[model samples]
Target: MKLICYLSLGSPSLEQSKINAQNYIDAGCDVVEVDFPAKDPYLDSPYIQSRMAEALASCDDYSEYMKTIEAIKAKNPNANFIVLTYENTIREIGISDFIDFCKRNHLKDIICVGNTHPEVRKELISNDLLISTYVQYHLIPEEVEVAQNTNGFIYLQAKSGGKYHDEYKDLKSIIRHLREDVKISNPIYCGVGISTPDDVAMVKAAGADGAFVGSTVLKLQEKPTELKEKIVALKART
Candidate 1:
């Protein structure tokens, strides 16, 4: 299973984010999803929100974020990078400019939190950037269509609500529904509170292509060794 780790641009520091990105790459994360610090990360939990807030306060502009991407790419040219940010940040930077920046930096995949619409979808694709969206419990026709159209893995949110901390619900049935009913051929990645090797194994057993982990990995910020160990264990399970 592909392991996707979340790292914030400004959290700790832009330089430190680069260090952590390299560390995670060395530790065996297939993709490091970098979050562009936002004033209000509506989809994130308090743990991540606080760190993003710190990052926003410390960094003067998006230059550090661009530099972080460059540094990570320098460390590993084949490293996979995904940007998980709000729409305002993308719009503030200007869609065309953002697309050009990502293209120049070799970044492609993006998860636009709090913004899932036709225009957002159209703009990303027009610039040759891939888009990703969430798949919840109730699969609406439009949601299924989005999942079918996304280039990367279909993000299967393993929870019910957008509260402080969402509980992980069993996704076997949801995955089944997506595959059988919706005919979603894109890779499915179950995430949200997926912290254990057992959780990763469960996703793999349920026919998912990978596991997306963020909060749990972020909690190990102070313990680099443990973080690597956890990632190794998670990868082994796959």
Candidate 2:
């Protein structure tokens, strides 16, 4: 099973963010989901929102952010990176330009969250960019269609934040539906509320291909040893 770690560019500090990224990769993360700081990261949890705010406050320049990512990539030559950002960010930099930027940086996977139009998704896919399809607790028909059509992995939410959907009783059932009913062969990675080794074990048991741990890893950023141990423990479950 893969372990994906989330890192906000320039969070805390550009130098420290690079350190954290290296630590996460060294600790056994298969992929790092890097987020470009946004003014309003409304979809994310409070923990992630604060990190993005910190990142923007430190450095809002896209070039600097790209340089930081480039530096990180230079250091970790074999590490996999997937870009995660809001649609507004992409709009700020034209879609074609953004695709060029990603290509130059060798980033093939992208997760453009928030109300993005289907045409935008199609354009990205047409340009050979792999974009994730999010599968929330509530399995709506539109989302199912997106999942079926996605060329990238499926991002499955592990925690519903309080909302309940009767279509699927549990994560396992949801996984089953995606596999059997939806006929989605792409990797399904479970995120949101994933923190502990137990959570990783639960996701693995639920038949997810991977687990994404973000807030918990960010919380331990100041403590490098503990953070590394935590990632090691989480990866062990997979």
Candidate 3:
């Protein structure tokens, strides 16, 4: 199982964000999902929203954000990275410009947090960029179709809000359904509400190919040792 860590670029400070990325890479994260700080990150949890807000306050320039990612990549030459941003950011940067920027930076994978238009998807595919498919616990037919067609991993939301639902709780069955019923062969990665080693274990046990962890990892940015420990523990579960 892969351990994917999320980090908001320029959070706190660019230098500190670089350090955090390096720490996570050294601690055995297979992939780091770098988020472009947005003025409003509505889809994220409070922890992420706060961090992104701080990141934007520090530096909202898209070029500067890509520079930071480049620096981190230079240090960890083999480390994998996936860009995470909202559709609004894409529109703000201009889709073609965004694609060019990512290509120039060697960033091949993206997880756009809002509805991506078909034209945008077609353009991304033509540019050889992989776009992740997101599936909620509700299991709508449209979501299943998207999952079936994606070349990238399917991002399965573990939980939406503070509330709980049986379908959400039964991730194993959901995974099975996606594979058997929906005929989606893409790797399924569960995120949201995954914050601990045990949570990582649970996702792995449920047959997920990977787990995306954010808030829990971000909360320990100040304590590098603790953060490394947490990452190592989480990776061990994989």
The global C-alpha lDDT for each of the candidates, from Candidate 1 onward, is: 0.78, 0.87, 0.86
Candidate 3: misplaced stretches above 4 Å?
Answer: 116-118, 159-169
lDDT of 1 at 47: 82
| Model 3, span 150-201: residue lDDT tens | 8778999875554334564578888988888778888889998899889999
In candidate 3, clashing pairs total 0
TM-score-wise, the better of 2 and 3 is 2
What would the per-residue lDDT of candidate 2 be over residues 93-147, giving only the tens digit for each residue? 6788778888888999999887756666677889999999898877777988988
Give candidate 1's whole-model lDDT: 0.78
Residue ranges of candidate 1 with Cα displaced over 4 Å: 116-118, 138-142, 159-170
Q: Which candidate number maximizes TM-score? A: 2
Model 3 lDDT at residue 170: 75
- Model 2 score (lDDT): 0.87
lDDT score, candidate 2, position 177: 90
Best by lDDT: 2
TM-score of each: 0.89, 0.94, 0.92
Residue 158 in candidate 2 has what lDDT? 88
lDDT of 1 by residue, 31-94 (tens): 8888888787877888888998999888858766877787778779988877887887777767
